[model samples]
Target: MMKSASTASRSSAVHMAVAFIAMGGWAAFANSAHPMPGPLIAGVVQGTLSALITLFLKRMIEALSARYPGSVGTWLPPLVAVLSSLALLSSVHWLAGTPEIVRTMAVPLSVTAVYATVYNLALRRVAAGGVG
Candidate 1:
């Protein structure tokens, strides 16, 4: 069954919240060893970044998958996601002075990569007239 627009909006909101809270909390905990207020600042930065990424991620994957076809379509979106995640997370965390940047980004990046891969695959399946 098709989802209503409100349902889709709610789902997006929930995803964004989870990304913001879980990834941000993880970043904060990972950076807790740093100086005062640093962890808090990192949490905010990571949370905002995670939320924005989650918000756009689905559309980005859909566009990328459509722009390519066949095997390239299957793999390219996820690869781009991983690269984008690394670039964005590392650069933003560095600018934010997030101590242990790699640690803070690891889980979020991994999750993004996995989600991108699975989502892309599902899109392909649905496009090919198979059950996603």
Candidate 2:
């Protein structure tokens, strides 16, 4: 059974929300372990921003998939989304003066990469008629 666009979008939004909370909680806990000020707030901020970024990236992937249909289209979008999101978030973190810049960026980037990969694979499988 195929899902309508609205249904798929809703499902993606839910997944993004869950990813945001999980990643945010982990980041907050990790930051608290370190001697940083306002760890909880920082974590929340990072997580929220990261989740938004992921959402945008997913949208980009969808657009690209539509523009270029084939294996190239299927695989390239996810890779581009991951790399672009990482760069954008890292830049944002640096400009925002986030403490432990590398570590902070790492948490979200790792989350995005994992999520994007799984998301892309699932999308491809679905596009291929659910044949894994």
Candidate 3:
């Protein structure tokens, strides 16, 4: 159980890292093509913030599960994380002068949604003594 939990956490972190890098790279490329300011820096900032958010979300989920220990604990944290992360990312991009804030967030938000869903399912399976 413990090992699976550790593995899941590590897996989630790695997934988030890769997603962040990919999304950042794409953002940078898009910004450059549009002749926008600070493409590289913007990408780096987005990626770093994404990774940090993922770390926080993972810890929050674990802590919630530890305290509540049921479906409520399992699902709520990821739900909250996804919503909050989206809001934060959108806010960051908007503040950075990224045009079409909603459009800018589309890919990253999709990636995060997928991650949250998978991570939650994996945790639930592991908790139920199934293969992670």
lDDT-superior candidate, 1 or 2:
1
lDDT for model 3: 0.71
lDDT of 2 at 123: 73
What lDDT score belongs to each candidate, Candidate 1 first?
A: 0.90, 0.71, 0.71
Q: Give me the candidate number with maximum lDDT.
A: 1
- Residue-wise C-alpha lDDT for candidate 3, range 1-101, written one tens digit per residue: 99987887678668678767977776676566555566775677677777777667667666655566677866776687778888898778877876445
RMSD of each: 2.9, 4.6, 5.1
Decreasing TM-score order of the candidates: 1, 3, 2
Candidate that beats the other on TM-score, 1 or 2, i.e. the better one? 1
User: Considering only N, C-alpha and C atoms within 3 Å, which residue pairs clash in candidate 2?
Assistant: none
List residue ranges in candidate 1 displaced over 4 A. 1-10
Segments of candidate 2 deviating more than 4 angstroms: 1-17, 33-38
Reference-based lDDT, residue 100, model 1 = 87
lDDT of 2 by residue, 79-115 (tens): 8877797777667766666666667667677766776
User: What residue pairs clash in candidate 1, if any at all?
Assistant: none
Q: Provide the lDDT at 61 for model 1.
A: 96
